[model samples]
Target: MNFCKRTDLILVLITAVVTTSILGFALSNQVVAQINGTQQQNQMDYTGFHSNIEQIIAHLEKAEYNKFFNNNTLTLGHALHPIEEVLTLVTIPLSTADSNLNDTYFKDLYQLSALASPGNSTVDEFDNKSKSSIELSNEVVATVIPATVLSTTEHNVSVIKDLLTISGSEYKEGVAGGNIILELEYQDGSAFMDRAYTLFNNTQNISNDTQSVTKLLSDFSNLTDSVQSLKEPAVIDQIIQKMNIGLSPNDNSTTSDVSSSQTSQDYIDTIRGLLNEVITAYESNDKIKAKELTTIAYLDNFEYIEASIGKELSDRGEALLREKLREQIDGNASIDEIKQNIADINKVLDDSAGFLDSNPK
Candidate 1:
């Protein structure tokens, strides 16, 4: 009996060891399979992240290029700005994944998407200015010089057109990536926005005159028409007509006083006073001041005509006239242009002779 019990106990111990080995092997295999699955998941996640980054980089490039006249001689001297092309590429190890990269990359994708405006985009302005410069140059070349010897002609022509034609070849000659004066995206860090807004606003700023000047012009236009109906000074009447009041040869100003039911004699006096000074400048042979005042007068009156009677002449009126005045005031006016303008004014004045005797307020 004692021998039988000892054998049974040894058999039980052997079975227990076998069962433990089998369970341990199964557990070890399960751990290895789990580890392999995790590695595969990490690789897929890395690939997806990389793809997202690539898409973002692509969109940023597209938006940036749209914001400029690329490789423009008048604009930045570069095939592309660094902000448009350069991106900081990141490679994350499997042991380390960066959360900041994920957040920033996604945000960039949203901003550079086509759904956003990018604000004050230079795309239209640059395209128009650059293309218009070329087209206008071609037109002037055709109009001013015949097909006969246009290549050898030496006639002075459109100021902007000449600048564009001479500089057309310069667009392709710059470094591939030059220094960027403006950034490629929206920015609130400064008064001026980045590349997009900076470039579009630059050309417009040069053309924008002050509100005070614009208002003074409106006042003068109204006063000239009022002075015409009264019979006092022939010289003043001629001056009123010569100023191009309401853009008519006859002085007929657009009245804004219909709502208020009062005509302004003060505006008349102010306009008369300014003309009095202009007359003095012309009479004293101060060509510079006369030209300056004439430039202001032309532009101001033109703005009035543009605001009032210029809807019909929208395509033809005031544009070239304003540009000419801008050139005169900004010192780009040629001596010939200035002399011609003065001669036109003098012609009108000469038509109404003996005007000094009929002058009294």
Candidate 2:
């Protein structure tokens, strides 16, 4: 009876050891899986961000093309529309990734936008600024997105399709009643098409679907001409159908959800920080730095929330404040004058902040 009891005790101990080992292995595997899942999600996010950067570069090029090649300032301004839409998505993630880079990036982007404006910048100035923005965009993609996850074809396809859909919708809105009723909308639609085609051409060069890609390229060429000629909405729709595309139901919001992505206080804080920097620059007699910082303050931060702030303060009111600050910095106003300008701007920001607080999105 003593020997039997000894054998049974050994068996029980062995069973417990095996059970613990199995559980340990299972738990470790679960942990690894969770980590992988997280990495994949992060990759997806960065991939989408990278795509937006590419589109921005494309739109900037198209904007230049319209301004110089086509001599169409209106189309150039319209190109800024999509850039504005994507810049909103770019700002927060970019700020999170690298704050200094974000500031410089927006400075260049704002410069580019200003240069691209009608009768605002010469060809040389626009060319230089657009080139700078494009280079920065490339750098951004390299910095933000990992090399291993660069060529996710499905995500690229989805993004292209979304741009195409947006293009079609914008075109339809612009050409109601078989007429170009809304010129800005029509120009914006053309801009979207330019972006969509740019993306498609890049993707097609690497894509394996030769037959479909070729067909789509042909359709895009036709669609571009049709859009430019102010064809009826139905013509655009039929061409879109031939492309066999659909807007991404799940991921489309990533581009246009800029306004809701951050709170009013967030923008206000950014504006305040830039304003403070402007003051520091001014105190040091760095007029160039002061003016540059001031431009960034309005273009990068204030412009982001101008529409929202306009609800609380009239657009003209905010514009006057911005102009006052710029004028002070440019005219070499006293430090007190600059501070007062900043104070006025802050008062308007404060009012907008309160309004946003009372009615949060």
Candidate 3:
């Protein structure tokens, strides 16, 4: 009986030892599998985090390219769609305990965000290119259509007026009309430049007054100089700087000073009065009053500029007006004929101003 009992106890001890060893081996394997799975998950998360930032940047670049160069409306819409997805993906890793991973992801996120917003130099180029495209498109349309249709069409006028109203309201509320006038002045100045070359070449044969020819040549030279100056990168930079300073909410202090100098309530009132006169003259068939009012209205805005440049611009405008008036008097002397001339000149002036007024710079 003693031998049997001893043998039974030894068997029980061996069985207990075997069972504990098996359980340890099983537990070790499970821990190893869990660690491997966790590592794979971390690697995937890191990959996804980087991919999200890249996608965000890619979309933003596409939007900018579409806006400035391609003008691909469809691509622009496509580009914005991924922004929300990127934002969501970027936030996923933020909840993780890894500080290094979070910092890396956030850095890329910030850069992408900056690229998407205005004020970055890239955005300025994009804005300028887009604006130039719109201007060029408008010019092409203007050449194909009559000035009457260009100025009076409700659709065209309303769109332009709304844009002007928005720009003015956002930047210089209550002086939307002044913005219109300033634009007119620039347009008149541009038209005068276009005619200068022809006028200069023809003046030698047409005019006996050497002084007038000399003055015309000098004016042409000055206008050419101004055009060249406008093309310079520095000048463009200055204009952009001024626009940013004037338009940015953060730069209100500087903008207020510039605004006070460039625009005023009186200027706005004068432009409004001029617009009314133009509309009335066009509708009433008053040729003389229309031409005179157009000239006066354009000149009024020059008062806001420096004395020298303003006077030069004003003189150039006056000379052009005189030439147009002379042509009208010679070709047709009847009252009806004169009315038509006035209407035509007014229409041209209005169209020229309308283009500039719609575009601030």
Candidate 4:
């Protein structure tokens, strides 16, 4: 009986140990399966995230290239669409078995996107286009503006010239007849002036008295000869000096003072007065006075006057004035009619001048 009882106790102990061992093994296997399943899910998530990011990048590159090709001008505004989309994709929660892997993936995507987007080129292109547009606009202005102002100036000059010829012829037609002085002066002044003066003079000589014409011609010839002999280079030198002074990059205060002193309103007014005097001398039948005034006026204010008018007017105005002159010559408009037309045009220009002063470029 004692031996049987001991054997029974041993059997119970063995059974208990076997049961515990089996439970432990099962629990260990279950834990390992759960870990493996989680890892597989994480791998799948990573692969999807990476693939989506690549698609976003591809779209951005395409958009950027499209904009670049279309306008030949790049800008950040163009990239806004692509960048917003990329950020949305990057911010989405990505599953990763390791937290560190998720952080690294996001960080790299952000950096790469930034690198691929246009930055300096966009800024530079905007700046360049703006500057170019401004420059072209300035060119057009430079061409058109000066010509407009100079038209009035040239008309005023032509009026004075015509009056001089008429008066000079009346006083001494013998001197005025073959007088090429007016022709020379007009030719040197402007092509329009030359053509107009030649046409007018030729027409007048055809009907005028021969002796009077001869006298006027001789006097004008002598006058021109005297001018040629003077040989004074002072006027040209003054112009060069003034130009040099104006162009110097001095302080604004000094430049303002110099330009003001050099460009006195009185100088401009004096030229206008001199031009009027030339007309007065002619209408009064005083060839001597007309010739004297012409010499003095040419010496005192011609260069300054011409320079001022030239600077104020632009190339486009010059072209338009030429066109108008051609039309007038072809139509055979009288001098008085032409003068009235000029006055009307000048009124318009004066209004424009006022506008320009009020609203500076």
lDDT of each: 0.28, 0.58, 0.35, 0.32
Against the true structure, candidate 1 reaches a TM-score of: 0.20
Ranking by lDDT: 2, 3, 4, 1
Among the numbered candidates, top TM-score falls to: 2
Give the residue spans of candidate 4 off by over 4 A: 1-264, 291-299, 305-361
Assess every candidate by TM-score.
0.20, 0.51, 0.19, 0.20
Clashing pairs in 2: none
Score candidate 1 by lDDT.
0.28
**Per-residue accuracy of model 1 over 108-151 as CA lDDT, tens digit each:** 32222212232323566444443433343233234322344333
Q: What is the lDDT of residue 66 in candidate 4?
A: 42
**Candidate 4 lowest-lDDT run of ten:** 28-37
Q: Per-residue lDDT tens digits of candidate 3, residues 228-336?
A: 3444323322433343332222434342233344443344345446545545654554433344344344433323322222333334433434334433422334555
* lDDT by residue for model 2 (91-118), tens: 5455555656866776666556555545
The list of candidate 1 runs beyond 4 A from truth reads 1-279, 311-361
Alpha-carbon RMSD to native, per candidate:
37.1, 22.3, 34.8, 43.3
Q: Report the lDDT tens digits of candidate 4 across residue range 8-53.
A: 3433443343233222221111111101011212222222232223
Best by lDDT: 2
RMSD of model 1, in Å? Answer: 37.1
